[model samples]
Target: MTDYGNIDVEQFFTGDPIEDWLDLKRREDISTGTVDSLVQKLQTNSDGTAFQQFLSNRDVGVLDATVMDLYDYRDFIREVNSKREMKNKLSEVSTFYNDMRRLKQTDSNPAAFVLSRTDTRVKLPNREYHTVEAMGDFLAFIPHPQMQTMCLCYLKYGLRRGAVVNIDLCCVNIDDPRYRPILMNAISNFIGRYAAVRIPYIFTETSAQMMWLMVRNVATETSATTMSYFRSTTR
Candidate 1:
């Protein structure tokens, strides 16, 4: 939603005020952020025409109608009640209209604007991390060269750590001289497992598994040294 946007607000409460309901929901043990976001999403719909129409039809000269007045029979009330299905769509339509308005090229509705609160959460862009000493110790453990070569081979071929530890069969190909003899075998599913399906790889010995191990050792050591400095500083 645009920060510069505002429109006159009209409130409609068919059975109960929505904000009151949100207040009650917030009083429970549920997530505070969820409650806040829900209220914010609803408040975004200030320019809803159908909402305005619903309010317009029901507006009294004064807010003096008794509880019994709502149930009292009127022909137009029955017609309006028949259109109850349309009320919920107003939020969605208003959002769509606002999207068009932001383009500022073709949207004709000068009055249309979304009034939602801006998201407070912001994600910073990704950047390379500085290396330190602990990272070297961890990498040192990988190139142990004794364990059956599968441990080092797995990482050497760029396979995941978990996959390296778990694979017993053809994952570590011992006979191939041209390749690193380690292969990426399996990953799981989207809704199901931690990762989905297998991605296959065949790396030549020329791919330099030994060099990768050396680099990993250097990086891990550098990271660990950095962490030790921070620990001392904090203490």
Candidate 2:
């Protein structure tokens, strides 16, 4: 039996290089999700014929396929796919050849030699920003104090919704005397443990006070059992 790292090539090489490579991947304990994705990519093509069928039609096994064969396949991929998709398809092909080389099934990776003419870097669309007046009007329409505070936090800190939601009460320190009673109540009921050192918070003094006031009102009004500063009453 041919020893290729941990895999026994003699037992697994069943004439189909793609099937052998996939089986090797499974033997290596690759994640099921990852293996399933690879299988889907190999079997599905826009033109009804899969990559293995394309190789078979060219009268070449994967291990014996030439660089020119890969270039032709790349062209086929480009015909119906986006530049990004073509890049991904070629990358998967290259990965398969790389594994073949590792298993000593092939001496060279022909897919690695294939090159593309298209610029594959996907450009993100430009985002439009609201004017100051527009932002004020939008904030004015949000009726809940908690939601209004959350929106203000987004505008002031440029924080994502998830980040705002995950902000624990212990993360902020509001020293305003007017809000001290509410802050004390929150601290007493706060279930989350404080870190050894103060966590670096992004909120300014005014914004922190606003958030505390909103939290205080929310805690008093709602039956939310969650200890998170941003309490949701809905199940």
Candidate 3:
């Protein structure tokens, strides 16, 4: 027999198992927002029976619920809930069963069996793509040099916002007269250290020059050895 020494098994097995699971989640330091969402998804009765009451009516405890019972519940919710809401409900119940299994309270997770099909019910819309001319017009109107350089990087490299923000000065090699003034000033302190680094040029010469010009105009002090390529001047 498994030894559940000092474990309060009664907390999970007696009264409402859903409430017990939520209480345990609170003790585990789950964020209040997450716990409130779980409560809304699992216990709210705006449309029909609460999940706990539904299980109770069927004479099925959380540990004893079969995959078929969960499927029946899915059908019940489908009548009133949108496809996305139905999917979220199933996902939260699956998480509840998973936690019960971890505590050795049940041998099977019935909710897990049905979660795989939840995505097939919801159809996602196709993404729209912008034409090059449209993107160019948009870039032309962005008043700031920094914003223009960021848009150029996105256009050329398909870089995400975080990826663009995380770019370091040492990553690119710029060789343009427009950039020389700012580049000389920005890297004056790190000349010897980065001289032989030989990092390849990721940005086009024009974009690199624009980025350097933005950096020179915004930064009051250029003494740092290394810094992010794009940063807020207000800081």
Candidate 4:
């Protein structure tokens, strides 16, 4: 036998069906965090993980899954977890099977049938709406300038937390001739390190440019202060 030195073994393993599905997602440029969460959910069954117990069985391949098997899994999920969690888990499984169908690995998505059942059972409350006055009162309660600026940006732009945190110094471009009262463009790091996406924030009452300028100045000043404190402590 020929000796193969220091060859990575992972290249050959190729992972289980669940992992294989997640790998397909990664190839499509899905975020690592999102894919990892799906994998975790697939591996963690009510009794012993849906993937390991159902899809991984050689005798009962994914293509062989019927609506009854899916219903059994749904009952198992409901037994082990809350209704909300069950809905979420079933949704993930449905998405996985749907994607598998798209890949021509399966002819039907049993998970989709199960998901529809769960959706009908779950009744989530309506999302709360905050008025302008309520928002003003909340803003007045915040003490830190950086936190206030960040919150204002999020409120004004309806940005997610990840988007708000990803705003970079380069995102501030007041000198551009096309610059309106709004920041026009803000960089959000929602897609992890792969790329920075442009997100625009519109100002209805407050000056968007001024808000961004404050964000930049406060963020820089806060960073400098924190570093200075760390240096002093270290010295």
- By TM-score, the best candidate is 2
C-alpha local distance difference test of each model? 0.44, 0.55, 0.55, 0.53
The lDDT of model 4 is 0.53
Q: Which residue pairs in model 4 clash with each other? A: 45-49
Tell me the TM-score of each prediction against the true structure.
0.17, 0.21, 0.20, 0.19
Screening candidate 2 with a backbone cut-off below 3 angstroms (N, C-alpha, C), the clashing residue pairs are none
Model 1 stretches with alpha carbons more than 4 Å out: 1-93, 105-148, 152-235
How do the residues 1-235 of candidate 1 rate in per-residue lDDT, one tens digit apiece?
A: 3576864344433344776678778889879889988887677554454434344456732256555544543444677676765766787677766766676624454333332333435343221232435333434543235532553453444323222232112323221332232322211121123223332222333223333443333334344455556657954
Tell me the spans in candidate 2 whose CA falls farther than 4 Å from its real position: 1-49, 82-155, 158-235
Per-residue CA lDDT of model 3 for 1-235, tens digit only, reads: 3585687778567977777788889989789999999988775664456765678888888789899988888887787578778889899888978777776658555455445535545332222344566556555645557856875764555323222332224333222245567675654533334445653223344434444433432331231223432434412
lDDT of 2 by residue, 97-164 (tens): 87767766575544443334334464432223445565555556445578567766656544232223
- Which ranges in model 3 have alpha carbons more than 4 Å from their true place? 2-8, 28-31, 44-235
lDDT of 2 at 229: 27
Clashing pairs in 3: none
Q: Report the Cα lDDT for candidate 2.
A: 0.55
lDDT at residue 105 of model 2 (Cα atoms): 56
Task: Write down the RMSD of all candidates, one decimal each.
Answer: 22.5, 21.4, 20.8, 23.1
lDDT of 4 by residue, 141-205 (tens): 44557856776765665423222232222323223344333334441221122233332333333
